[model samples]
Target chain A: MEKTWIANLLPQDEYREKRLLYFIAEAVFILGVSLFLYLMVESFIVEMDMPGDRMALLCIGFLITYTTLRSTLTGIEYPDVASEKRYQKEKRLRIYSTIHFWIIFLFISILFKGIPSNLEETFDIGGSATFAAIFFFILNYLSLKKSYKKNKDLLDD
Target chain B: MSLNNDRKIRNRIAVLRAEWNLSQKQLAEELGVSRQTIHSLEKNKYNPSLKLAFEISLFFGVALQEVFQYEEEEA
Candidate 1:
């Protein structure tokens, strides 16, 4: 006999709907954490006598990181391609897109922000952006790998 | 369902399920897959893996060729 709790939690007949609901719940949780982080950053900037614009930049960075992490963790099944190929394509697309976006962002920043006018500030922005990009890319790769491994049996190929 | 392309892998799963007096949900449970997967297979929108194909043939006590046929266009 199937376990009652498991049946109730994941009714086999409603598997697709349940999966969608789980994804939404996860997205909400991620959003909540990001909001909390934004508040903490706001308080930190105020305490440090930093500029208000810094807070906005940090929040944007945090949102980008949160979005990348969420996509990595969600494991939403791709409907088009088979399993392994789909995961590989997803991983490649994610890394490439993140890198492309960051490059554009850096160019825009350098153009508008005048290259920070100092060696120290230039290093700070460049180093932080590079670190964040690397961190996001790695997170995406590992998460996709894990999801692919876990769902191998469920997928078509 | 109407045959769309000569390159498609044709399956008789719906007919077999009817003969066995099984619903899509029951067949999916027996095959250890989602009901949606069974529906997709019946509609020929998704191809089953080799293991799944073998399992289906085994479950129905029929040859694999009897359950699945690959149709090709004539020259």
Candidate 2:
């Protein structure tokens, strides 16, 4: 059914190749910019003799929150991957990850002789670490639920 | 196509789309897939699942064999 056209789009292979090149260019640009920003901030902090702990925490927290929000709302897929395929793959990956995390956590708890109830029974992990772990787990679970909800329609498609 | 996959699939989607004067975007919308997927199919870079393969041939008003060719890898 080949028809002549006065004007036409690029061939499919060329289109995919060009799209991949664009993605690479963008990714490289983003990485370079972020690195530059990080270096500038770090140099400033070092010159000011500022304690890096709080800054590191803030940066990590901000990145985590930003990524979680994005993934939860938008769903994460590669540029060329289909949303429905991504939904299916992500669902399987999440399940596997959760199971692996729990298995490791259980192993750690058993090694530590049951989970600590209070600071006195620290089990070598301080209160903050435990709290952070629980918080992270809850956030992860919530994000997965949101992702599933956002991508559920992809299944029908 | 997967890097390690031995099966080779080639399809005449580009031919059909060109014959129909359909753009990648148009075929993608008609097939309920992304333009990138159509591109991949045309390039033989990705193998469509049986369901998708059938849908594509059906959309082109062609038989499955007319649309898709399967080749075995040399041992």
Candidate 3:
């Protein structure tokens, strides 16, 4: 019988190995992004001595969205055409829940931080960038949870 | 668990799949799994779930007992 490429893409391991690989990959990705952001912010501070970065915030927002979506989508598997409906349900639930948490957490953080002293100017740029990181961090948790849920659902069904 | 009589078991799977006039893709889709699963099953590299076993039986128009049989092989 001919092999479909999808099967090769599927995570093939017991739960422990799968979880370990997932967390490791997540940590690596987060570390890479954090390092890049640290360098960029440091360079901006050193060179321009700017109070905030509008471009960087926009770039970070897009990067976080793209990475979160890509990683989350890659891990999903449907048993058959009949399962697509259920897959869609699970996908929606996972994504919406993530978004909800992101928004809530952002507001909570802003309230706790009591707005930066340079709110008007900084918010026009750096504020959103900070929010983007928060969004991605929350998304990381959501994606990890979704991955585990996918495995559990498969075993259950 | 390992195959009790590996060679004959391998031969049985090939025979069954061929007799049904089903392609690997078709069988995999019918089984609600990826094509690699069918290949692995054919190669005896992976075991099927009970649900998968029932589906195979239904697909081949055979009882599970007919599709898979245990033959004790002496060392």
Candidate 4:
């Protein structure tokens, strides 16, 4: 049962040989998330002084959030390569993620806005991150569109 | 491991599937693989492991060479 679950963690097209690696990765992932969560709760909610600065914690939190979300996505299934529903879902999620990313950045900047006139520097950094995010989003969208076209040909032939 | 591998394997999955009157999803179920895998095989997007290749040929009741052909690398 445990093995079955681990094997299922991979997409259907993936090799069963990856199950062991996937299991180890899952264990490591759980441990890392638990450590991070404990540190975050202790440092912020519990108001305890940890070793690192809050900025470090913030950076770690953002990285975990971004990677965790991406890790969950297995990308398009082969059968749905050029399906309308699949394309629509991809498009929708692209917009949703871009908006959410900007929202998080803006929120963080506003939180820091409460501090010093460091507002200018913070906004500039936010602008750079947002600019990168937008470019990444556009690049993904264009490639995905191209893939849909190609996949259609694959299915047709 | 990646779609951009220089070596490619060509297969007659689509033709065989058609002759068998089997859809990609049905063949996937028979082969204990995903429909996506079936589609990938038909499109030459992936090269199955040796075990899977043998299983596929067996399932189609054909010789391995009849089902899959190795394409020489381009110079």
How does each model score on TM-score? 0.40, 0.34, 0.34, 0.48
Q: What TM-score does candidate 3 reach?
A: 0.34
On TM-score, the candidate that comes out on top is 4
Model 2 TM:
0.34
User: Chain B vs. true chain B: TM-score for each candidate?
Assistant: 0.87, 0.85, 0.72, 0.85
Error of 1 at A75 (Å): 1.2
DockQ of each: 0.05, 0.06, 0.08, 0.18
Give Cα distance to truth, residue A26, candidate 3, Å: 18
Candidate 4 C-alpha lDDT tens digits along A45-121:
89666567775676566655444333333333233446799889988988898888777766776686553357687
RMSD of each: 15.9, 14.6, 13.0, 10.9
lDDT tens readout by residue for model 1, A1-157:
1446655644343334345545556656776787687678778755445577985777666666655455456443332223566777887898897798678767776777777878887987787678767876777667667556645634422
What is the i-RMS of every prediction? 10.3, 10.1, 10.5, 4.0
Cα lDDT tens digits for candidate 4, B8-67: 689999999999998876787898876656777787867787888999999999999999
By the DockQ metric, which is better: model 1 or model 3?
3
lDDT of 2 by residue, B1-75 (tens): 456567688889988998899877678889877665676678787777677889888998889999998877658
Q: Candidate 2 i-RMS (Å)?
A: 10.1
Model 1: residues >4 Å from true position, as ranges? A1-71, A77-90, B1-75
- Residue pair clashes in candidate 2: A1-B19, A2-B19, B1-B45, B1-B46
lDDT accuracy of residue A141 in candidate 2: 56
Error of 2 at B71 (Å): 30
Please provide, for model 3 over A1-157, each residue's C-alpha lDDT reduced to its tens digit, 9 standing for 90 to 100.
1256644644542222233345546655876797687679778766544345764675576665554465555443222222445556655665676567656666776676665568584464455646665665466556555654554443311
